[model samples]
Target: MRFSDFALGLGVAVFGIAVLLHVRTFPEIPGMQYGPAFFPGLIGAAFLICGVALVVGSVVRGAALTERFAERPAWFGDRLAVWRAVGVVLSVVAYALVSPVLGFLLTVALLTAGLLLLMGVRWVVVVPLMVLLPLFLHYGFAQGLRVPLPRGPLELLLF
Candidate 1:
């Protein structure tokens, strides 16, 4: 997908404005000079400046600034790309529904494997990553972050 500099700039400016506005409500840390909002506020200011620059650049260049961002994407005619995109959406939906029942490890493993296969990854590479990646992620989130993961029969045994 592509967007005219004008539209993209406007979007960035709006987002920056939103961030700056919302960050004002965050209370300053009692002991520290930099509050939670400090870094984000700086980022928002940067975004605002860059967005204005893009808008100005587009205006100066006299490009088609009013054109719709996504009239027809470059990949519109690519069937495989379209299907892969659909598969990603479907995968997310499937994960939401199946994760609770199958648990985090199993659900993520299945999702990773399925997506890898769909993307035409070799079985040799897919098999190891399918098992290892989910395990590592589960350990990191569940153990390191102390986040509670949904436990199914398999995880009930391991975790």
Candidate 2:
């Protein structure tokens, strides 16, 4: 559904302000010029500025406060688009629910392969991506970033 520029701007401004307030609660590092909150605060400030600009621009252009939701086309008007969106969402949800049981490698590989196939990708290309991508991401997160991912029976045997 479409929203009026003014409504969008107001919503964005409120979200930005909320982000700013939330980020302010992050603990500061001792003797650091830039702390944990620095990046988030910067993003919040940018959002706030952009939101204010949008609000002012909309007002200057004499835009309405709201748009007619019923005038918009049905969300599922395009069958392929709707199906693709649903497929992606379902794949991610399945990955989340099944990952702990099936492990990250198997679950993500299957999810990637399934999504690529859904998007009409060739099995030749899908096969390599399904295998390599999950391994690469696992290594990056588990080794490089030191973040632990869920490990199932297969992962336990291998790693």
Candidate 3:
């Protein structure tokens, strides 16, 4: 469930570098100083900086750098862990099977609430998340990214 700081930092640094390099291929906009790559490139740069900081900090802290790359998670021995894992997998499968028909908003709302309850989150938390999280995702994917999410009767009423 976890990796040593050195290992984790190395992976993050490599991922950050990859992102930065990949974003370099995005074509510039003719009239704009900031193109399609602007935000993503900034994010990649931030990642690179953070990753380097993590690596340096870990090294400076005198952590043996020999910490186990991975340790058996405590949950592995717990009986309910299997049910929890199964619940998560079932949620994903259910989402894939029903998302188009239910629409992104409804499907995500249901999935969020179900998973939260499965993980023993209280109703006070789950209720608001069920509503707000779906709307946030809809805005991010549908409005911000301009991706076309399937529309159901509820979406027709709302959007």
**Top lDDT prediction, candidate number:** 1
TM-scores vs. true structure, each candidate: 0.61, 0.56, 0.54
lDDT of 2 by residue, 22-86 (tens): 99899999999799899999899888888898788888887655443124447669887788889
For residues 42-66, could you state the per-residue lDDT of candidate 3 as single tens digits? 8888888878887787889876365
**Top model by TM-score, which number?**
1
Give, for candidate 3, the lowest lDDT window spanning 10 residues.
Answer: 63-72
lDDT digits (tens) for residues 59-122 of candidate 1: 8888645666545686779888888898899999998899899999999999999999888899
- Whole-model Cα lDDT per candidate? 0.89, 0.85, 0.86
Which structure is stronger by TM-score: 2 or 3?
2
Candidate 1 RMSD to the correct structure? 5.6
Least accurate 10 contiguous residues by lDDT in model 1: 63-72
- Deviation of model 3 at 106, angstroms: 17
Query: Can you list the residue pairs that collide in candidate 3?
Result: none
Regions more than 4 Å wrong, model 3: 98-159
